[model samples]
Target: MTAEHGPGASDIDESRIPSWIACEDLLVKMREELIDRAIKLLNREIESGHIAVNGSTLFSSEANADVEEAMYLINNLIDDSGRLHKEYSEYIEKNNGKKLSDAEAKKFGELQKFVLSVEQLNMLMEYARVLSSWADAAGKMIEGKDTEDILRKTIDKEELRKTVLEFFINDSECRVLLSSKEIEAIKSVLGA
Candidate 1:
C-alpha cells in the first residue's frame, strides 16, 4: 500500500498529521461555533413549531429533558476529542518530535482520524434538534401572558439576569436560548 491509498496503509508522516495543539484549537472553535449556530437555529425552530428528534414527538417537558441530555452528550464528545488531541500533543512532545514508531503512528493516526471525523460531522444539525426540543419545553413552561411567576419558578432569576448581562457585555450574536415570546416574558420578569 502507499500513502496515496489512504491513512494507515503506509508510513504515517508525523508532519502531515495536524499538531495536537492545532487540532485542539480547531475542535474548540468548531464546538463553540456549532453550538452557537445550533442554539440560534433551535430557538427559531421552536418558535416556528418545528423541532428535531429521533423521529418521535415528545411532550414539551420530555423533549426539553431529552434535548438537555443531547446537549450534554455532544459537549462530552467534544471535550473527549479535545483531550485526545492533548494526549497526542504530549506523546509527540515526549518524543521530542522524533518520527513515531509504527505502533505509535497507528495509534495516533487513529486518533487523528477520529478527531477529524468528529469535526466533519455537522454537529450543528444534531444540536439544533436537541436544543430545539429543550427550548420548546422551556418555552411552553414559560409561555403565558403573565409569566412573571412562572419565569421565576422555571429558572433562576439572577442567573437569567446575569446571562442577559453577559450576553450584552460580550456582544454575542447568537440568539437567546428561548423563543422570542418566551424571551420577552423573561425580560419582563428580569427587567432586562
Candidate 2:
C-alpha cells in the first residue's frame, strides 16, 4: 500500500476540507493528522502479520524504491515547472501593456494551474519530510537518546514561517482563497 492508503485517507469529500489558502496552522494540523493516521496504520501492520519485523525497524525495500521513484518524478516536475513559469513570465512581460489574446490567456491559465499543482506537491513533500524527522527524533528521545542536535537542525521555525508567508504573498490565486482574518494573521506574523 502507498503512504496515502491508510485509514481516513485523502479520498475524503472535497467539500468538507478547508480551502487551499486556509491559515497555515490549519493546513499543518490537517497534514499532521494524516501523517499520524498513516503512522498508526504502519504500527498496526507491523504488529499484525502484514509487515514482517526482523528485529530492526525498516520499511520494505519495495516501499523504499517507490519513494525513490516518487522523489525522482517530483524533482523533475519541479525543474520543468520552474522553467515553464520563467518562460511564461517572460512571454507576458514582452506584452508591454498589451492584453493577452484569448488563446494566450487560456494557455497562461493552464500554466498557472500546473505551477500551482507543483507548488502544492512541493509543500506536501516538505511537510512529510519535516514530520518524519520529528517523529524519528521523538522516538529517539523516548529511548533516552540525545536528540537535541537533530531537533535543533530540523526545526527552524522562523525560516518555515517566512517561507509560508512568502508563498501566500506570491500566489494570488491561493491568497484569494484565504479569509481576511487568515491574511491579517499572516501579515502580523510577518510584521507587515
Write the residue-wise lDDT of candidate 1 on 68-168 in tens digits. Answer: 65555455555565675577667645765568899977766655554444443334544433333333333554233233444354444445333432342
TM-scores for candidates 1 onward, in order: 0.27, 0.40
Alpha carbon lDDT of residue 191, candidate 1?
67
Over the stretch 28-140, how does candidate 2's per-residue lDDT look in tens digits?
53345433433444344445443343433333576576444445555555566677658766865675466889987776665555545555555655655554444443333
- Top-lDDT candidate index: 2
The residue ranges of model 1 lying beyond 4 angstroms of the native Cα positions read 1-79, 88-143, 147-149, 156-172, 175-184, 189-191
The lDDT, on a scale of 0 to 1, for candidate 2 is 0.47
Instruction: Quantify all predictions' global Cα lDDT against the true fold.
Output: 0.43, 0.47
